[model samples]
Target chain A: MVSSFLSGLLGVWVIGVSTIDAFEFEDEVERLRYSGLIAEFRCPKCLNTNLSGSDAPVARDLRRTVYRLVDEGMTDDQVRRYLQARYGDFVLYDPPVRANTWILWFGPPFLLLAGILVLRRIGSRMTRVSLSDDERARLEVIRKQ
Target chain B: MKRAVFFAPFIGFIALVAILYAGFHLNDPSHLPSALVGQRFPGFELPELTSGKVLGHQTLLGEIRLVNVWATWCPTCLHEHTTLMDIRRATGLSIVGINYRDDGEKARRWLSLYGDPYDFTIVDANGDLGVELGVYGAPETFIVDADGIIRFRHVGDVNDGNWNREFLPILDSLTDG
Candidate 1:
């Protein structure tokens, strides 16, 4: 019984130490917001990893900045804007709709519509091709045979 | 309409080829556009690398200078150092260094080993100024005009090839204006 109690105490101490490294939030909502924000921004120093996924020094700095901003009662949009102002729109995973980025936003749908139109045209043409009377007669002869 | 539709794919193929070819000729796509261009240099009161004396953004004012971000750990900075020295020798352009996230002793040693090209190096030990300036990595050079406004930023090494082709025109234009 004494050994089990000591083991339980050791486990609790280990958990406490691990938790100390994690950011403490007043509420669960704040914690969720912090995680969401870090996952949303790309690590500037890294090739393609998000802030939460990267071990780059710059990513760590950015994560701390995000935590501080969230803790200061700034809204999610305000936090995004703060990072965007410093790092440009490159930080945001979702590129903002702008004149240059219109192609990125609208290109796929436009291509899909064009594809549908082309496919529709081909489909309609396939149906519109009537069998010639000579071909019909050949078909009738083959069926009779 | 049918004729045009028939040629649509061909036109798209040509367009795609042209775009891809142009993209191949363009600079590295990973180079992020700087947000600080056309804006005033961010204010800071960081210590000088050698002196440890606090200096502000005002020190960079009243000149067309290059603010180069470097670190002892970054190998590219070492590769770009000779070019920086050449530019300093050739044109006498003021180059200010921001020693980003580096140990002061190593930085001083590196500078002494390789001839110093900067007007005065700023020790950004904690990288607060680096964050404010939107620096993600080392060897980023910003061209700051006389009014202390950032004109252009080059993300990679500044060599003779790019120095003449990319940087000199901007410097010339800034001088003329």
Candidate 2:
């Protein structure tokens, strides 16, 4: 079946495909061929919940661009990288962040640290007395008796 | 010091907006762009595959119409075609079909084999129109009313409950007035 499908696809390609890049297949084949890839590629703008075109404009354009690249024999990662370079890392749903993306990479953790400091200050002011006399007595009993 | 005073609230609001926007993006479509219920229908223009003439989108003035995106090769589309025919016979609403990324001959054959309930079938062979309409997959159905507004859009196969349990009755209610 796979061989037959490949052969049939080859036959179809002979007519529609021109110089690899100049060729255009039947529309359904184009959409189906890319659907396998497009569905998995989450739209960076809409995040993970929506794939590259859940009625979102940016998602739609990305889907079109991804399909065009895939049809041109580019792997999914290659297509992703091309989009990343052109549109910045924001275009990729999950972009690898290193030295180049220190701001986006470390922003959340930095905010968390600030939040911890704020919470600590608030906690300090709200609750004052440390160890009560009764608590001291209990500790002394645990330590001695 | 002068700049900080004016920029304080503005910066805070900007941060809040960014976080909120990111959060919304992270959330489901049930939250983002969820105004199909009350707003105008999504208007789209797609040329026919063979003739290249435009189709549908104008008929959706105020009454509910089923806008289904389909193609010959999609198996899921075959499953829903029968359901669509049943809806056409029972409800009598305008059903517009967007033939996404398919050849003309195959599309005609697919319809000839099972049935064709589409009031108007738009051919979007290159996905340009599909891109414009924000179509990601085949067998997506949008409920548009006569006022050229989208009522609902269901991705994937349309189950029996989608019509018998949910949409049909809602469409029935809309047509009441």
Candidate 3:
């Protein structure tokens, strides 16, 4: 009963914290855009972490930059381009499809297809090797013995 | 078909291993390419290091120059100071400094003690301009052409080896052009 009551209290606290500290936005659409972009921008200082998830000093500064630019009525693409101009293409979690990245995009599916083909071949070969009638009779006699 | 399929996975695995080995051997993770390269330097208005006079990006234009991002707190800056002085004396190339995230008094004192090598140091106390320049660490040197396009950026201390081997060749090419 105590544990259940404590869990209920924790749930209420989490909800209150999340709801109360959501930065006030003049436009609801703008706030949504801010959250979306933060999740998309890579933290320059952290490996494989988005700006919204990082607590690095550079990440904090980048978040402020996003907020300032968004507040100034810059579109999402413009804000992205601004960061790209400084931090390079690496700052985008989803880099643009290009000649250099073609392998990264197509490699997994190709590998999967190859794997399936290999598995199918092996499965067929295993089925094709079903024991001959004499071999099967010998196995049955062995089991009886 | 069965034989080919059996061999395919091994061939593919070998190929993948070779590719992974080449990538790990060739690529340096610490050296990230700067988007600002081949682009114009970002504009900023910063106070000159001891002087109260304000300077902007325009002040750096009209000459082939080196803009070095440095700070009093960074020990690497001390190591690169003599090298910067040598470059200034040897090439007579304009070397501008960006004093990043430092107290004005401390920066001035640091320079005073070290024998200032910069043509003019811009005080970037808040590092706002450093952010604009995409500087993550101190002692990053940028080579800007007369047109103000950034040609090269050196991220670490500019010792004799880099100065002679890396920087000089590029400086010669830019100047020749």
Candidate 4:
């Protein structure tokens, strides 16, 4: 339990370092305000990039919309949920598990399971036999040492 | 299909990692682009919007300058115009605009209604100029140093808050020398 709590705090610190405040405004001159809000939580379809402007025009437009919403006072999570309401769970950058993202939610264990099953099936078989006198003597010597 | 399903979870894990890798690749949401940040500016010759005369890369050197990528068709650009005007007024920063993919009449009208804060405006009707500058959208902007290296890039409208918060400090840091 203590380990879990420590790690949770660590997670917050990590986010603090990685992401700047999405909505803090200073003056009215520079662009890129609220730029980090949405794409940080939104997913892209195929590109290696975030839902950020990638080669996909749609992704770029969605990011622009996110900037607009964040500037209009939507929190990062609120903007993500808004996309969820409109486009379902897949639109989320860090998507929640659902009927659609079953693959994402259950994928790791399934892989581990398959690996475990394959390993168990192919692993060295358990064999039972009375120990030979020589092996017993070797064990006795090792134990004594 | 069941085989695919049987392997789906592992594939999904691998794919998720790939997806995450890609997302982080674009993680900054274009606070900066992949190239040209802190790099020397590429050279270009553009016809001056007002005079139909050519201006080249050399003209941009020797001062802190702003390269604003904007369009009359973009309402967000309109939203940012006032903030940009205020910045221009305060700093006397050499301001330039790319009339991106826009008609001259509309560009002229936009400047009229919104007030042009730019010292130089160039026609980029086909976005060729924008392509060179790595512009992905209408309201993108960049801050270039006197050495012609790009110091900053903003991928959306510059509003009041961003001006006070991010830009001023960055510009101050850049110009402090």
Candidate 5:
């Protein structure tokens, strides 16, 4: 009797958690796409939060739009473009590489290359340090002592 | 070469400071640029705020106007209400309001109390139109040209300072040409 009651309670708990973001999807692939798209987009109101994570009204509306588009069999790229058209590239976490965004994409790798070059230059200087003849003689005398 | 190498770190530090300072002064981080600018305003069929009459995007076409997003819940909208009224009175410019994510009854009451400046307010209780317009919050205004294309968008209150500085130039150009 206790086991049966416990199982019933677990069922209720599972239902409760599942219904939190209770958008129903007939197809598993569509459901996954909906979830993926929401997680990918930034909430316009809540700057730091993704659509999946934000409870903002705008986020909720955007989520519904994404769900509707996915259900209608729109491709992921089309869905992204739809949002990008409305919200600009700011809605996407991964901004496309464009003239303005070139620095954002290439700046880090360029910095790494520059850092390596700088380190190599410093390393060469340290390794190629040569003692003068007087200093060498002094060092030899110190070694003999 | 050696002097250049020695001064590199200082030059880099100065460059970093200059970049940061420019970034700080150049743009307001909270203000997201609108993608709808220069594009036709998104099509929508929504009800009018007072009357139950359903309206479409065609209603707003053929005029240079200000489409202002507002809500009873947003305190800033209340602050901006008088400015909108002043604009309406001064220029007789067509101003349309989008009642975003708000109860119609309360919105109606608020407008009556505050004096409605909108020529015809679009009821967006569910914020569907707000989503289409990329509205993040209330008190955002869009300047739409006579051709129904959005010319510019201003986020936050349409105060006198910004009116003169940011919006006036655009408004003047749109009116003149």
Candidate 6:
């Protein structure tokens, strides 16, 4: 029974290894397009995971879609636009600077400006405080005493 | 000056908290926004489930219809079956089914057992159209207007609460128009 179980485990491992890398491309350009798209497109169902990396059903469906479109002679922009139209902007990792997402694009720069302003104000305040010569001499006298 | 600078972070924190608080109110987490809204339904040729007759965009053109993407494998579709039946009966609204990524025999059997609620069912065995529609999972429904434009999408099981809240209002307004 133990021997049979070990063989079963080995069989499962072999199948798993074979299945994950099963996708084939018709040509090099299609393969390149497929790989590039998979990295860029987000899986709608698995929010954080991209289409190529995710094993989620929706991701797999999207991958198949990308392959079909690429095979059908669609350009990279067309493929991206088609997906964006179907899945909305959420499916693209780098979403466009639209009304809804302008904050996302601008927020970091805005925060940086705010940070610089604060730092400059603090720096100025720090520079304003200096030891007078009299105070320095008094400190020297105290140290000597 | 130092105090004001220190207070800036606290003010920013409070502003963030307020924005987040407002965002929570604005967001309805249940609804997955449909990309097809305001756009015409994706054209497709599908074999009708019962008759195996080919139906395409022309079949869905005239009526304000509900296209439900469902399969036997999806548990929520089973739960939503009765609600679908009632919607058909009550409103007499045409509910078209897209049997997403499912076996034809299994889908037919499941529908017969559950009681067929759909006016017509489209067999999407390979889920080609489902991918085009960006269907994430089963039991996703779209409300298509008379002009073939997709008006709204409901992403999960259509229970009484959602029906009353979500589907009814749209139905009323569309009918009113």
> Per-prediction TM-score of chain B?
0.89, 0.71, 0.91, 0.80, 0.94, 0.90
Candidate 4 at A40: error in angstroms? Answer: 26
lDDT (tens digit, per residue) of candidate 2 on B146-173: 7776667676778897677767776777
When summed lDDT is taken over every stretch of 10 residues in candidate 2 chain B, the lowest stretch is B30-39
Question: Which residues of candidate 4, in runs, are more than 4 Å off?
Answer: A1-145, B1-32
How far out, in Å, is residue B125 in model 6? 0.6
Note the DockQ of each predicted structure. Answer: 0.43, 0.04, 0.47, 0.03, 0.52, 0.38
Q: Please report, in order, the local distance difference test score of every candidate based on alpha carbons.
A: 0.87, 0.65, 0.82, 0.69, 0.87, 0.84
Model with the higher lDDT, candidate 1 or 5: 5
User: Which residue pairs in candidate 3 have backbone atoms (N, alpha carbon, C) closer than 3 angstroms, thus clashing?
Assistant: none
- Candidate 1 stretches with Cα past 4 Å from truth are A1-26, A130-135, A142-145, B1-25
Q: What is the TM-score of chain B in candidate 6?
A: 0.90
Show the lowest summed lDDT stretch of 10 residues, model 6 chain A.
A13-22
Q: Considering TM-score, where higher is better, how would the candidates rank from best to worst?
A: 5, 6, 1, 3, 4, 2
TM-score of 2: 0.51
> What value does the interface RMSD of model 1 take?
1.7
Candidate 3, residue B19: the lDDT equals: 85
DockQ of 2: 0.04
Question: Which ten contiguous residues of candidate 3 chain A have the minimum total lDDT?
Answer: A13-22
- Quickly count the clashes in candidate 3: 0
lDDT of 4 by residue, A1-145 (tens): 9988986786575344333334344433222334454445444334345564344544544555665676677666676665554334444456566685686678667778877865554453334346899999999999999
For model 6 the TM-score comes to: 0.86
lDDT of 1 by residue, B91-126 (tens): 999999999999999999999999999999999887
- Full ranking by DockQ: 5, 3, 1, 6, 2, 4
Candidate 6, residues A1-145, lDDT tens digits: the string is 9988986786575444322535677865666667778878878887787787788777777888888888899999999999989988888889889898776687657666777888888888899988899999999999998
- Which candidate leads the pack in lDDT? 5
Off by over 4 Å in 2: A1-145, B1-39, B42-44, B49-52
Which is superior by DockQ, 1 or 6?
1
Q: B47 in model 2: Cα distance from truth in Å?
A: 3.2
